[model samples]
Target: MIQTLPLALPGALVDTHRIDLSALYSTGWGVEAHDVAVAPNGEVYALYGVHRYTHGVADDEADPATANLGYRIITRYAADGEVLASAVCCPSDGDGDDSAVVNGGEMTLCVLPDGTLAISARPDCTTLVAPDLGQVLAAYDSNDRRPFEKFTPGDAFASSISVTPSGRLLCVTTEYGVWKYGNTLANVVGVADGPLTPASKPVIEAIASLDPAPTRYGEDDRRDHVRYQGDPVGFDHRPRPALTERLAGEDRLAGWRDSRLGRPVPLADDLFVLPVYGRTFRGGSRGRPFVFALVDDQGAMTGRLGGMDAWDDSPFTGFCFNVASDPHRGRAFHLNRYGLYAWDSSGTLRARLGTDTKTFKPLSRFTLATCSPAGELLLVHTTQHLVLRVPTPDDLADLAPAVEQALRTYARQRTALKSRWSPVNWHWTHTTTVHHL
Candidate 1:
């Protein structure tokens, strides 16, 4: 683990501390960390990589190959803050195999309670597994039944994966719908085919099911009738002499019409479908949406909280980019681009703090953000960082008695040692020595 010396504090200064994690890893240039997961034992795993695209060369042609090539990398840090392992996913440059170039983006990492690390890469739904330490595990894609068959023309990126309380894994993709698999990473493989449908197929069906069916080819019937529904013009049909003006005006009018009508319509029921976090058990409910449920290992719902809603008056929309549970306050704290917000375990919005007050400084330049399993907020914004501890009223109450005793002892010690060192005497006798003989 990386450590730094304590800073001299001003009067009544709160002790701000943060661990500089980059000091422990060799993160390459042009790479940015996307997400981080901390294990129960305090080990931190980060998902990060470079974004690029690779191209393919044509047959029988001497032309240079041109395709977008991207790289994905994953690294694991030990509990003590040492880089234990690292892995990258990239296209092979060998001459034998020729295929379309691959690309990856938007990575996420999660550590199972049993100590397995799950790293999910997006735009291509693949999960790399690192089950134990000291082993250089070769990265593998989630097993594809139709490995030879092309499902989508481009890459299928995996977005996020979360481990349920019962240990099952739930993963979502940019193109493929959400899926749940058995607790282990092996079970999650190929399970995507059994019950889940690819994202494209369902969308095509939904479009076909629209009431006013989309036309493949026909005359421009919808455009001819221009009903003057709003207001009547004061002047018309006066300037009909210039051909160039008419043609230019026609082009501008046509462009505006196309912009208004040519947009693709969204599928129905799309907005109501909430993104599932994971399938977990608490008491009674089974296979419930983790979005609005206080789920536990038994698939039962507990606590007074449910899923969070959009912040109606605020910009963040209430969905937290990162969240940490504070059992001491019975709440979960979140950090958005704006400020901090808190919700109860039941997913109820408890308080909107630090927005207007600015009691907590904004995260201006943090490279990585993590919440301690114990509920402290750690931000690695700079080479020198700051850690903010937000204690609830209950935390203060727990420390009340001890705080009083510690203050009394500090006052007694300070008074006893006040006159022991004099500034003038130290300057005059620079080589003064203590004599005990």
Candidate 2:
């Protein structure tokens, strides 16, 4: 039965639909939904990673041999929760070359204006899957680009990505900052910041482990870090092993694992917001607060939206995992240890809906959220293996007619660009990728 619950806000109800993911997380595997995105046509696409694990292993039984599985899979579902199609776009050889079969994190996904899907996995793997959800159409990774070739794997990773209404691709990386690429994933149009200051220790290890020296990629820097040419707009934008200390002897970690970057929320014009959070060792504090970096399709940082700060000593932690925006309402939604937060484009907090009590309990299980074309929210509850469809509350009323018209205008601009793109043949090589129709 599809379960429905009253949201903290009046006149709003949430529908919970459980997704049967048992097969993906059976005995020796740990699976997580990297991200969930809803297409304009009401189809849902979820990107998940099935990692390998061995528990209760007799200390010497050479872990039971397991079949090689693709590190990640993108599943499509109808609005009513019926499975539509699924395919493994990333292959793992268990050699950790192309994709990580285990211990991979920080992936993001978004549906392009042309109905295709774009997904990014850690260590620099970004692929565009066909609309039918059957194959990978094009791919970009550390192996294919120049600036990407010079840095360590983390430097090239696409922590977050969003396609502009004009069909440009905006991406955020660990070290190289943000980038703007052509929709075809063929060329880079811009860049921002100079790679993260002084690569971290882990990145150093990755550099030393590379064999035969990395090859160079030939591409001009082009329009690197063009200052935000668009008008000002509002938006908003962690991980740590502190789990061991908190859980004590529980033998398990509680709470959701946040990806490196939350899913990007598209806003007016060519702008989008990317949430940034991570652990900070300074002053012995646990983690950093969330910051919403507002950038346009040209890879320029326009403005930043602030989030909760730890110093406030508030009951809830200031960290957030993901953010979704309702461009129609000019509002953005952020999820954190506290609950779901709603903010306007000007960065004003309008509401904070707590899910820790009442009909909507256990906010900790929801790892991420994506807004649908119809203005509904698609949230993922990991612990329950469910997806919750949340309608906009009455309090989040529609924008003035003028503002609504502007949004419609922006969307129309996107639709006109769709003709520039046509589906490509599934020619990428992924020996282990399975097409699960």
Q: Which structure among the candidates has the greatest TM-score?
A: 2
Shift of residue 198 alpha carbon in model 2, Å: 34
Error in Å for residue 6 of model 2: 21
Query: What would you estimate as the lDDT of candidate 2?
Result: 0.44
**What shift in Å separates residue 334 of candidate 1 from its native position after superposition?**
2.1
TM-score of 2: 0.57
lDDT of 1 by residue, 368-401 (tens): 2444444444333232221222223343333333
Q: For residues 156-268, could you state the per-residue lDDT of candidate 2 as single tens digits?
A: 43444554444444554332222222111211122222221112101101100001111222232211222223311101011111211222342223221221334456664
Q: Report the error of model 2 at residue 261, Å.
A: 6.2
Give the root-mean-square deviation of each candidate in angstroms. Answer: 20.7, 15.1
TM-score of each: 0.42, 0.57
